[model samples]
Target: MGFLLNNRVGHLLIAIMLFVAVVAVLLLIAKVADGLRGKARMPAVIAVFAGPALLMLAVGLIYPFIRTVWMSFMDARSQNFIGFDNYVTALTADASVIAFRNTFLWVILTPLLSTTIGLVYAVLIDQSRLEKAAKALLFLPMAISFVGAGIIWRFVYDYKGAGQDQIGVINALLNSVGLAPVRFLQDAPGNTIFLILVLVWIEAGFAMVILSAAIKAVPVDIIEAARLDGANSWELFRNITVPSIRPSLVVVLTTISIATLKIFDITRTMTGAQFDTQVLANQMYDQSFVFGNNGLGSAMAVFIFLLVVPLVVFNVRQMAKNREVRG
Candidate 1:
């Protein structure tokens, strides 16, 4: 088995297997398409089938993830042999430490702010006449990609010197209010907050949609009973609404947390990891491609994988628990 998996013959055999798999899928799809043309509405049913899509997923996503993990343990050029020295350097190195700190701060802030704002919006918008419109407006930001959002916000944070025409929204407003035009993305703490606001703006909508659905899924009978028992709005929400949607809350938290851990685009686009706004993912890109320090980059990648895996597992377990509860 080892010989089969390790040699040139093994590579050739794997390629052959993959080729056969693709041909078989294409043949099956062609047959399905032909059969569907003879029967109206059956095509829709066939479209929903995910077997072929899963094969693509296995090759595209799962394979690459496994390959990255393997490479993390290997040497810089992905040849030669090295042990845990990369991991050790990642933990203790100056650049890595800075990246780790920034990522930790993002992890702490992003999920909390996004989830809190989303939950509040969800609660307020539930069953309201303006629910659809409010959700549409809030969720509009989610439609924008990270790069687009960063570009938009770049103007928002644009700094101008004394008495010059302030092009940035923030500086314009500050000047109008008789306040100094603050450098929003120049300072350390300020730049971090500015970047965080972009993420919160994008992710809050996701949180709101998921949480709103969860809120609606709360049993009406339970809410009515609580109200009838003289429970106030807060009490009813706490006792009846929140507990019912606790699982969705957990899911949203973990999802946002995972997203936060992999936050690269905003930092990369807005700050270029400058002004001490660097996070783990951006640092990994910089170390690997920009700086050509593959060892450090792989270490950062491994660290991100480690951080995300536990949260993902926890989310899965929470989902299973929810399923069991429902059952």
Candidate 2:
């Protein structure tokens, strides 16, 4: 059994057997449901379908969340109750303080910059001759995984000491212009800004795609009516286009904000959370896994969850309000 579990062919066979077992059980459930009376049949069928899903959710999501919250109040070894000490350390520790500051910078800058750039680009290319090509070109970066994008940009920002042959595109350009190469990843404060730019670049395409659809969905008749009323370009956009797509704007902004808040890949791949570029997610991972400080890590996780809940709640409320307005 151990050998079978370790072998590739055995793994495939085991997966196939599990799949077959699940199908047989589902079939048996359906047969039993069919034999039952009206009320019993409906309830049994519902239970057959929903029971596994609910069980999985309880085990996978709810249990882990509860465990993490419980651990957040315990000591590093989870052997003793430490109360709010871990939370205090997470908030007040020098590394954690820098992590929080950098996370704030990411949350603020990535969403706004990506959305603004995407909105402008979408507007500029809407109904244009090369709209498809232009959008495809802009969106190509989005196809790359965050790690891949980080590696690509690492080359773009790579630096070497003075009087050395520069291989990085940005540094090479600088060298060509008689300017010294800048250590974009190694520099503090500003390195965080450069890292934020990578996320913006990758997310801008997503923002443009969403906002473009929203812009196109605006009522053409309303646009014509506004134009006939002597509304100029800026007026039409400000009073018409912006208001019409406000819900989409909210969605794009909040979605990107949530994603930015949970940022891990770019920081991990590009800088390894070094040079004060650590965000909450990376810090949580390092504390819990690398340093074996589960208490502090869980505290960071809970703090992130707290920060995210408000954004998610706001987004849902806006979506519901939009639905009511449309209805």
Candidate 3:
């Protein structure tokens, strides 16, 4: 069995055989159940189908969540139960407090900036002759993972000090205008903003793609009617386009806001959450793995879950409302 597992040819053969066997079994079940009554057949099929999924969900998601919640109430070592002390400690610690502030800023700024820029970009491309191509170019950043985007922007924000020739594009542009090189990553409040911009860059494409679809879905007749009534470009956008895509805008904002909250990779890759650049997700990791404080980490994890569930619920509600509107 070990040799078969280690052999790539054997592994591939086993996997193929298993898939074929499963298909054969399912067909055999269907054939055998063909003569069965409706209620009996549906029960058989659901037991076969949903049983494994329910079991896996129970084991993977439900159990782990329960354990984490329990652990959050425990001590750092998980030996003794400390109730809300871990939560208090996480809330009161200076670094954790900073993390909360930075996270709040990210959750607020990233969505608004990304959504606004993307909406504008979508609107601009809507009028362009090469609409598809323009939107495609703008949407290219969504193809890159957060880590990959962070690496690209890390060099863009790179600082080589004054007079030594700026390698980073931003500093180079500043140099061309005869300005001093600023430490883009080392500063406190400003660095946080710079880091948020990276997320915005990666997220803008996603927002643009969704919003562009919504914009195009606006009724051509309504737009024409408004135009005939002497409504200008700004009026058409503010009245027709904006109102038509309002639901999509809500989805985009809430979705990006949630992404911003759970953001970890970019911040970790760029600054390692150093210099007051830490957000909740990275701080959770830092507490759990780096500092070996499971209690605090679990608290942060629970807090993140609490924060995210509402945004997800809101997005779902908005999507449902959009569907109702369409209906």
Residues 143-261, candidate 2, lDDT per residue (tens digit)? 99999999999999988888999999999999999999999999899999999999999999999999999999999999999999999988988999999999999999999999999
Better of 2 and 3 by lDDT: 2
Off by over 4 Å in 1: 1-21, 24-63, 73-75
- Location of the lowest summed lDDT over 10 successive residues in candidate 2: 2-11
TM-score of each: 0.82, 0.91, 0.88
Candidate 3 lDDT over residue span 1-327, tens digit each:
777667988779898998798668767777766767877888667756775688779989999999999999998888899999989988999999999999999999999999999999999988689998988887888999999999999999989977798998899999999899999999999999999999898889999999999998998999999999999999999999998898999999999998898999999999999989999999999999998999999999999999999999999999899999989
Once model 2 is optimally superposed onto the true structure by TM-score, how far is the C-alpha of residue 168 displaced, in angstroms? Answer: 1.4
Model 3: ten consecutive residues of lowest lDDT: 43-52
Q: Give the RMSD in angstroms, all C-alphas superposed, for model 3.
A: 3.7
Off by over 4 Å in 2: 1-28, 323-327
Cα-based lDDT for every prediction? 0.87, 0.94, 0.91
Q: Is candidate 1 or candidate 3 better by TM-score?
A: 3
lDDT of 1 by residue, 175-203 (tens): 99888898888898779988998999999
